[model samples]
Target chain A: MPEKPDRNAIEVRGVRKVFGTGENAVAALATVSVSIRENEFFTLLGPSGCGKTTLLRLIAGFDYPSAGEILLYGDDIAPQPPFRRPVNTVFQSYALFPHMTVAENIGFGLEMLNKPKAEVKARVAEMLRLVRMEQLANRRTSQISGGQQQRVALARALAPQPKVLLLDEPLSALDYKLRKDMQIELKRLQGETGITFIFVTHDQEEALTMSDRIAVMSAGRILQVGAPRDIYDRPADRFVADFIGESNFLKGDVTGTDGGRATVKLSSGTEIRASLPEGFSPSGSVTVVVRPEHAQLAAADGGAALQGTVENVVYLGTDTHFHLRLDDGVPFIVRRQNARGGADSFAAGSRAGVVIGGDAAQVLRD
Target chain B: MASAEEIARAADRKDIRDRWLLSAPALIIILVAATGPLLIVLVYSFLTSAAYGGVEWKFSPEAWVSVFLERDIFDDTLSLADANITIFWRSIKLALMTTVVTLALGFPTAYFMATRSEKTRDLWLFLITIPFWTNLLIRTFAVLQIIRNEGIINTLLMKAGIISAPIQILFTDTAILIGMAYVYLPLMVLPIYASMEKLDFRLVEAGYDLYASRWQVLRRIILPLVKPGVIAGSILVFIPAIGAYVTPSILGGGKNMMISNFIELQFGQAHNWPLGSALAITVMVIVMIALLVYVRNTGAASGERRG
Candidate 1:
């Protein structure tokens, strides 16, 4: 109860959504509840059909839950129309009005609010500057590039200065370079506007880079909600572990526990120590998940190491990825930063040691 | 041998020649079948008429003058009073009425059709065209059977006790208008439906998201985007409805005469071929002028979308 101490910018409590009816009913979301704090850059990260978009739509007033309350800044706005809501969405398609000029599209929300012409003009000019689209203000939306159109959409949504901004995969259409550029721009925009941004994206890296806190959703349920570091380092379950980043899972039996750390003995009798996650059981089979980046390949060691022959060495601009396997044929990967340590590179068929620190590997419940 | 640049220019000229060659057949057909008759009619309008419903092979300005003047063949003085102008005005009014009524009725139906699922829209479109499969005269008579007193509609309404008297809906201007609309309803619907089909519903959603009221969004966004369809539908309905002959002849009881009906009288019972030609030429000129203006406006609107 004390965890969410501050006032919530948007609270979606006990929301359920079922599409269609009768025999064809689909449960898009079930018992979804999350409180987003003001000025927090929160992202709902999930694969397609995970109901992340459903939850965002419910908050934006584009959709209503079949059963539950949606409170925007402590006021229930469930029955209100989208136009009546104090939130704006940057749509996935960057839904710019093609008939209108960029400035007109940006100033549309202000015009709808009955703002004076001079004030609307000033705000629109400021927004154009904010999005670095001041020179393209007079051009029609159809005349702008995809990235420029994206900025116009962002500027248009932000021009209204809503309590919360909902972005529905706003960067999925952009290429890699542009998407990366906009991620930083979006973070800066959120910071400057000081508005709660509930962004939805399937891209894990995009979610990690822009969000202060992220809620990992799957099958219409929130699997975990925490800061980007927390979600990446200590994922709640196997699904979260496999989804966030690349990891090598080793099936092992717990041999012993040393306070916070537990030593697990592998099938090949190789003993490794790893930090136990919460509620970790002792003296049973467990799965030890270690990221490729966390495990390092060194000279064959005598203790606390899984010895394998280097089967492949791949140079990826920033790091070297070495594929190896234990004597029992258990495959392992080690991603070593190219700039770190000695100039020695492991060749295929060379004996190597896979060293994962106790805290580097994560153990999950089942 | 041609140089590289000269060869490129030659290839471009060959490309242009091939394009023109591909269109030549249709162009030839249009000129021969469509404009050929109109050109003959245009020539006939300036010629003199003989004593017994034939041409005299002489040039005269009498057919053009007769539209607004009444004069004896031997008389030098011309009276500005004429019934032809009245008939022309009445035909214009009736055609305008048909267009306005069909537009009002067809717009909503086309919008509904456009909003339907693809299969449902196809089914409705097929049904709309089914009426066109029948002969135009037969379709007009079919409407006659439905709306006439003591007909199916009258019997049904009387049987339902909604009407004690047989409704006098037959052989009136209302009947002609109804027949025209029923015949031309598909024309108005098809182009509008085509336009609406291509519309992005996301634009409407974006409008609503920007705090625009439904009506404001429709007026500001939906209407403008679909303007091309409305213009196309209007042209499709207007040009043909203005020159319609049979709908008025069959349903008008010869009382509500359109310009086509008047032109028919000139060529048939009235025996004034030059006058008919002149009136036909005049109507064609008017329709062309209207179409040119509409095309100009639509071209300007389409420019905004492109730029």
Candidate 2:
């Protein structure tokens, strides 16, 4: 056998998965396509039941696509069994064998191949060290804590040095503090291992913190695939803009277009201009997405520019958020830092002025 | 002038008395039903036999010595002593054979049932238990019908022209084994199924995901996980098979005389009560020793140290 060239770790082309037949059929993935490069930390972020984990299984060879093909390192792997494929998965449950010790669990695959006893022992020891669980090597799975068991599971999966690692909500079982800590550890581990990681999660914050590139999915379709900053700063449509992070959607109509910029007239009778993204047309109903921190609040008696009344106010230690209702009754939220004496301090139940510029918002054409 | 400590002690005594009162009736019944017979068996094993076939006032080891020494005091041409030893050995061998066969057939069937969908598993479980629904004697006789000479098997063989005369199938060790295994197969399956069903299948999948072959997953992960079930099932089948009397009697047709048959003969036809009691005592001791050895070798008792 000849050694193959380095290629994309996983490539999925037009994959479709239908759960049942006839009247009960559900199309879980519809012509979904993406390629995960080697050594990249890629996330498939979606809401629940969005076919993200299904896509990961398809790439790992645990499932077969009803209609398209999957390739591992440039060779078609759609027909290969999960064991034969050079991919390992960290399941959501951490599925460690309850009867085996931590060492035995880590060395199971090597022992399965009838490797030399000394070699298996050495590899198991090395993996234990890698996961910082050397002291727990002899402990039975039932004796360990949840986070420790998770590390043991990860060591077992990574011991084979697979070309790709698939993680399906592996951190969902941990506590909030542990989950946050593990996320950073996982990102660092991925960088050190340098294997392609296709992570499936429904958490947007986690996805934003860890991924090199993310594929946002909805209703079994890939809405956008780009760097985290691109997906967050320049979303493709209304759904992508609202799903990735908090955005105050202002319903408006496109008034004019100049190059890549568009001026839109809001239903509140305020004209806000924003730089339109590539291929966005001006002359139809559109919505502008403004981040809360981008809008400023000013006192109504100061004769400030945009007019509104403070509906609600929340002080969050670092910043204060004001919910402003304009004359047209359209609610907009504005966030301001609690700086000593900068500007624009409005009290609740008082009139306020909201100011937003073109660069602070993005026009979303649905 | 009672102190607080005295009052507390009185209350504690009352609580203990109340608990004992609640449990007394059930405990008394258990003692009568279980301990009474056991104590009688122990006392009878040590006592000397009276000439009129009742208990003697003297304590003696005469019965134990005679059984262990395999003496033939009667010195008749057809010695009952020789027959008893032969029957005891035959029974042990048949029981061992039945246990092995049952485990071989039952383990995989249990695994298959455990891994199936709930509805299909229940249907298969029902099918496995169908033969057990009939009386054990009726089922043993049904085996005799199938394998006896001039029976269904011999008739089919003759019609197929495979043999010149009816082959002798019953009245042999093979017939007794088949009957015993058929009767005890369900006993073996249920325990194994319970254990295999509790196994976490994700562990097996994890084996595969880590690049283990299918055979490796089965041998290393699945087999170890279900070992408890196998041991439990084997004990369930073997212990009962050793004491089984009706199946061998009907199917063996007097050719395969096990220990129970000899005990039955000593009491029923031979009119020797001392020897029958001796044989029963010997069988009980042997079963106890076998159970102790099994528990030690399997480390099953140690595994239960948690609870």
Candidate 3:
């Protein structure tokens, strides 16, 4: 730990936040602890009511933890108010001051810090430039479009140079195209500022696109934390694999075991080699998770493959998905990249063999 | 044969005309019933005052002149109308004080009401408007019973050993101010509450997130956003307080005669019909000025909001 290179910017140590009192109390966060590194873009991702926003609010000092320490650069910030903390939030609604001009909104935080007027002006100009909103600086927030207002909210939060910036589903309000653009823009801003950003989102795609690391949450608990590639490739559990993307789960028995790898026997009597999660020793029964793109349909000429019948065919532009039912009645999908004559290669009501690629199937821990 | 487009255009014109025709009765009633008395008052102000307490046929500017100037009996020289000016100034000052007092009391009340749950907010608003159900005269009398020397306030104070005797508070400017503020408080609270309720509390959260203290948030964000309601409430209170008759007549007694009382004296005891009309017109002018300020302020604020 002493030899670690990157310093921790924020350390939430054994935090618990329970709303209400007595029997009606709901635990929004149950003994959650995490360490976010300096200049890292960390994301807390989950579905709605998954306590991601609750954690963000606790970090931003809008609410205090029921028990535990929230340390910012090794100092406890749990007892501080939002204004007293060196953290700012870009709220979900954007919450731009409607009465003030974009420039005024940007400078509001700097002014609150008792910065010199000239310095505030300079910083406001710099923020407006950073957000590419110099043209609309003199316009009221209400006069601007929603995307522009979002930029102002970002600029306002960043004006005072907070050590940590919290974004609460900031892109959720934007349309699909704008959201896509802002995902890149937000990543770029984080890189440029070098400020530790703790983002809360329910969108897995957004978390994958912008985060340096993601903590997948569910029911007020962090199930796993890893890089996007690590998460998508080597999910820690059934929930992580199922929540992150599309997966086909097949019931299987562990026939053999190796270092971080296991041979699983499916109900169809086909043996498939799948990788195990770290420190996981599978026994009699387990679930084999496979992605559709990792599997393919082959001729059922009595080859060494799983036997299944093609139920339907979906011809996407770049790829075609073959919906198949295994001989044991477990539905499975196989996606093949479409080439010439590949679109209608497999028709409905045809017998096919299912081939799962090596290192593509994982033995998931339930 | 005419085309369908031409027929539709003709129908549209006829429909508009029919709509106006349908509204004409209400429009006519508003014009005649509202403007008729104002027109009569304006005309009366320009006519000569008869000795017997009505206007004469001859046209004269004496009533208008006496509004701001008067002739000395011995020297026969024109001098500033000190008596009328004092009464007019006192009326304006009291109206302003009433507006300030109600605002001081109403702003926090409205903010508290707006912050409550929607179901409870309606109850609070209903309570604020309970005064409106009772007659204005009766409400003023209720205030009188509370503040009078031998009334509830003094009696309670004496019984509690806080005072040796009853303090005379009934026939004072402070008494009139209290009555006017009590009567007009609902006007101030309703508009401010309307604005505060529309306020997106997330902006207050945003303020705190941006390092603003609670006081700073109130000053920079909450105050500016709710200013339109403040201006509206001030106008509502000020206009009526300027021409307040019952509250002042009862609470102020004879010693503190406001512009309304002075005007009444012109028609009742002074027997000068033209002067009374002129005084009434002056009060209208003051109200018009207050309304103008309100329009300009809210207009600018709304334009910013809309833009």
Candidate 4:
């Protein structure tokens, strides 16, 4: 279908992939569908074997969905092979050609496209510059370090100006400092090129740092999709809240709702007010999800709170974590800002009262 | 009591002595078996061949000259009608052909083996090596039965109405080449398979991701990467095939002589010790040169790999 390049870059519709047959069957992805906007830095973030990489491979045409279609610019490209697709992948291993020089590796895609030699040279040079690897253009891949090889892999993929660039945990191989630097570089690259990037990663922080939007996946399904702040602020379920960051869940039943807030009655006869997520009914079973940083150890005089013994004290550099257990056998953790003497004020086995603010806790459907 | 430093030094010395002792047996065997015979060949190549089979122990260039030039007893002139050079060139030609055939047959099999599932790959590798367990001569003899007149292949073809008579395959250069290639097939396949098995197919995926067609990927990426293994396997086949004595004599029916058969003739039938020694020394020199070239190429390839 004829369409503008600025249209939706990718639309994976009801895609499913099963790896084997009979007793050994593995459903790598199941009826997963998402729309990735053109020029958006989209990430599929999940733990390993969560089907994020499977979806990326499907988009890049390295793999085909067992059912359903993947459309590129409104064209169903599910039947197409990888080389025929408009998408390129920076593989997780950086899979740079060992025998070729960095320049040759970068030019390979352009040459495969049958571009004129001069234009190929110009584009390769531009890619090398974009990756900040001009100095390493002549070096063979084996002569370079892992970080340099990573840049070469990027340049090689970007040389042909593919409409959609797929990256599979490209920073997983880097050290902490290099990963930090690359996260920034990747955002800049995505911005400058305005190419749709479907990046697959298992790192929540990396997804938050680089992506315009992220789809959190688990057990071969997309749990939620939103901007980083939206995901961190309002997780859709217990899994999303727990997977994204540290969160404490208190199993409760919603007792009442007023205006936009919900009052959930905990099993221990304590009640906490939380904003009810849409589709959650009053008087139904719900889980109140509170980020550890949102709950704090309060003074004994604070009203309407759960009092528990501090089971463990962890003095993190910027924050101290209190692992608390209520007398009813419910365990939860509280993270507070370690300002001056604020930390080390609570000793293990000491009694502490934790207050869960209505604005800080979220009511999840499940 | 000795100081700690002195104690450590003594321990280090003992360790060094132990290391030497561990390798001493193999080293002594190599010296006696390899270097000792090589020395005899070097000396005997320079000395005169007696009227009999033994060396005369006198300085002479006759044996060396016989490899390239022949004395004209009637006209006192040197001509290049030497049978030794012909046999030498014939051996090189046969070895080259054998190497080419083995590579053509081996590379695809190795690639096929590499692509199989791990358990299937083991089975195929074992099958490729099965021929090696049998003696080379016995295996060649089996091939003779298959290709010879009134042999199994001919009987099958005749029974199937495909041929009225057996084709003239035995006792030909083609047969010799077939025998050589068959003998060296495993040598070629094993190394090429090793390299193919070690290949990072992720690079092949990367190639396709970068818009390379399957042909382009195979030619530009797979071919260049697997060349090192092919070269290694080629050397393993070529060097041994160049000095091949049994295959040609059996397959060539004692008439189609190679340099090795000529060397044998000089030592046995012709009873010329010095000429035989010279030919043996020359063959060794050629094999050594081939080895140096292979090592140089492999060294450069590995250096590039380190990049």
Pick the DockQ winner.
Answer: 3
In model 4, the runs with Cα more than 4 Å from the true position are: A1-6, A255-263, A268-283, A295-317, A320-328, A338-358, B1-28, B46-52, B55-59, B159-162, B290-307
Q: lDDT by residue for model 4 over A273-334, one digit each (tens)?
A: 88876665667777788888888787554664787889999888888888999767888899
How does each model score on TM-score? 0.91, 0.88, 0.92, 0.87
Best by lDDT: 3
**Candidate 2, B87-172: lDDT as tens digits:** 78888899999999999999889989999998998899899889867988788888999999979989999999999799887999
For model 3, which pairs clash? A143-B307
Better of 3 and 4 by lDDT: 3
Each model's chain A TM-score: 0.92, 0.92, 0.96, 0.94
* Models ranked on DockQ: 3, 1, 4, 2
DockQ of each: 0.50, 0.45, 0.51, 0.48
Q: How does candidate 1 score on lDDT?
A: 0.87
lDDT of candidate 4 over B1-307, digit per residue (tens): 9999999999999999999999999999999999999899889989988776888979998888877788899996889955767788888899989999999999999999999999999999999989989998899998888888878878999999999978888998888998899999999999999999999999889988988999999888998899879888999999899999989999888878988888889888798988889889889888888789878977887677445
TM-score of chain B of each: 0.90, 0.83, 0.91, 0.88
The all-Cα superposition gives candidate 2 an RMSD in Å to the true structure of 4.3
Q: How do the residues A1-366 of candidate 3 rate in per-residue lDDT, one tens digit apiece? A: 112238899999999999999999999999999999988899999989889999999988888899999999999999999999999999999999988889889999999999999999999999999999999988978788999989989999999999999999999999999999999999889888988999999899999988989999999999898989888888888899889988888998999998889999988778889999888897999998888888877888567458888999888889888888888898888888988764486789999887787888888878
In model 2, the fraction of reference contacts reproduced equals 0.65
List residue ranges in candidate 1 displaced over 4 A: A1-5, A254-283, B12-22, B72-82, B159-162, B297-307
lDDT of 2: 0.84
